[model samples]
Target: MLPTEKDAGSASMSQVSTSTERANQADVAYGRLKQLILDGTLPAGAQMLEQEAATRLEMSRTPVREAMVRLRQEGMVEIRPRHGMRVLPISASDMAEIYAVLTALEGTAAELVAQRGITPRQLAQLRGAVADMQTALERSDLKAWAAADEQFHLHLVRLSGNSRLIQMVGQLWDQAHRARMLTLQLRPTPSNSVKEHADLVDAIAAGDGPRARKVHEDHRRRAGTMLVDLLDRLGLNQL
Candidate 1:
C-alpha cells in the first residue's frame, strides 16, 4: 500500500523534530563543557576521551563529540584522532596578543557606540554594570566584579551594532577566560578598572567618541601590560 500524504507529512515532521532535539542536545553539551573549561573545573592540560566526557556531561557521545569539535574550533581544545580532547592553555604571550586585538576592536566599538548615541535605557544599563562593579569591589568580591566588568564591556560592544565585531570579541573572551580568572586574584584589586569603566560610561553618555575610545584603549593597554608582567614575573608560562 502507498503511504498517504498525511503519513508522509507526519514522517517529515518527525525528522524535523529529531533534528531539533539533536541540535538542542548538542548545544547543552557545548555549554556545559565550555563552562567546565572556563571555570577551571576542566583545567588547562586536562585530557579526556569522548566517552568519558559524555559520561561526565550525562549526554550521549554524539553530542559530546559535536561540542568537542566546536571547542576545538574556538582554540579551547585539541582533538587527536583517537585521543579525544585535550584542553588548551593560554600562554602569557597569547594573552598579550589577545589583549592587543581586544584593545583595538573594543576601542572602536566604544567609539561607534558614542557616535551612534544610545538610548537612555542603554546608558542606564552601562551605568548599572559599572555600579555593580563598584559595589562588588567594595565588598572585596573580585568574582562578582569580574562578572560585572565583563557585562559592561560586552554590552558596550554590542551597542556598536556590529555583529561581526561582537562575534569576534566574544570568541576572544572565551579564549581568554581562563587566564583572566587565574590572574584575577594574583594581581592587585581592580579599583582602577572600576573607575576607568565609570569614566568610560560617562564618555559614552556624553557622546564623546574620541574620549571614549582613548579612555577604553588606555585601560585595556594598562590591563594587558599588568597581566603580562605578572604572568612573566611569576613564571606562569601557561594558564
Candidate 2:
C-alpha cells in the first residue's frame, strides 16, 4: 500500500533533519582540522586520509569530504585523484611572499590604529594578548605562545576597525600558519620580540602612526629573514 500524506511529510522532515545535522558535523570537523593544522599537530607536508580523519573526528565520510573541500578552497590541501589530499608544505618562496605581504598589511593596520589612537579598552586587548604570550613563554608552552602571537597581530588589525584589512590579513595569516610554526620551533625567539610588542602597543597608545608602522614593519621583516635563513640551511630553497 502507498504511504499516507502525513507519513510522507514526516519522512521528508526526517531527511531534512539528517541533512542539517550532517552539515553541522561538517562544520565541527572543519574547525577541528583547521586548528590541528595551525598548531602543528598535522605538520606541514602531512598526508590527510579521508577514512582516517573521519575515524579520528568520529564523523562520517560525507562530512569529512565537506571539510576537505573547504580546506582545498583555502589552498591548505591538495586533492590528488588516486593519492588523496596532501597538506601543502610552506616553501621558501611561500614564506618570502607571505611575510612581505603581511608586513605591508599589518604595518598599515598599526598606522591606522595609531593615527586614531586606541581607547583604553583596545589597549587592554592588545596588552592582554602580549601578556599571554609572555606567560606562555615562561611556561615553555610553545603551542600556547604561538596562539597568543597570532592573537596579538590579529587584535592589532581588528583595532583598525577596517573589515577589509582584517579579512585580507587574516587570509594571509592562515596560509602562512605552518611556516610560522616552523619558524617558532627552529629559531630562538629573542626576548626583545616581546618588548617589541610592548613598543607597538605604546606607539598606538600615544597615537604615533609612523612609529607604529615602523615597529611592525621591522618586526615582521626580521622574522621573515630568520625563517628564510632557516629554510636555506635546510636546503628547502624554493618553498
For candidate 1, write residues 1-239 as lDDT tens digits. Answer: 99999999999999999999999999999999999999999999999899998898888999999999999998999998878999999999999999999999999999999999999999999999999999999999999999998999889999999999999999999887789998898999887987899899899989999999999999999999999999999999999
TM-score of each: 0.96, 0.81
Global Cα lDDT for candidate 2: 0.85
Report the C-alpha lDDT of model 2 over 82-177, residue by residue, as the tens digit: 565677777888888889999999999999999977788889999999999899889888878888888999889988889988988877899887
- Each prediction's whole-model lDDT (CA): 0.94, 0.85
RMSD of each: 1.2, 3.4
After superposition, candidate 2 runs with Cα above 4 Å error? 1-20, 134-144, 236-239
TM-score of model 2 vs. true structure: 0.81
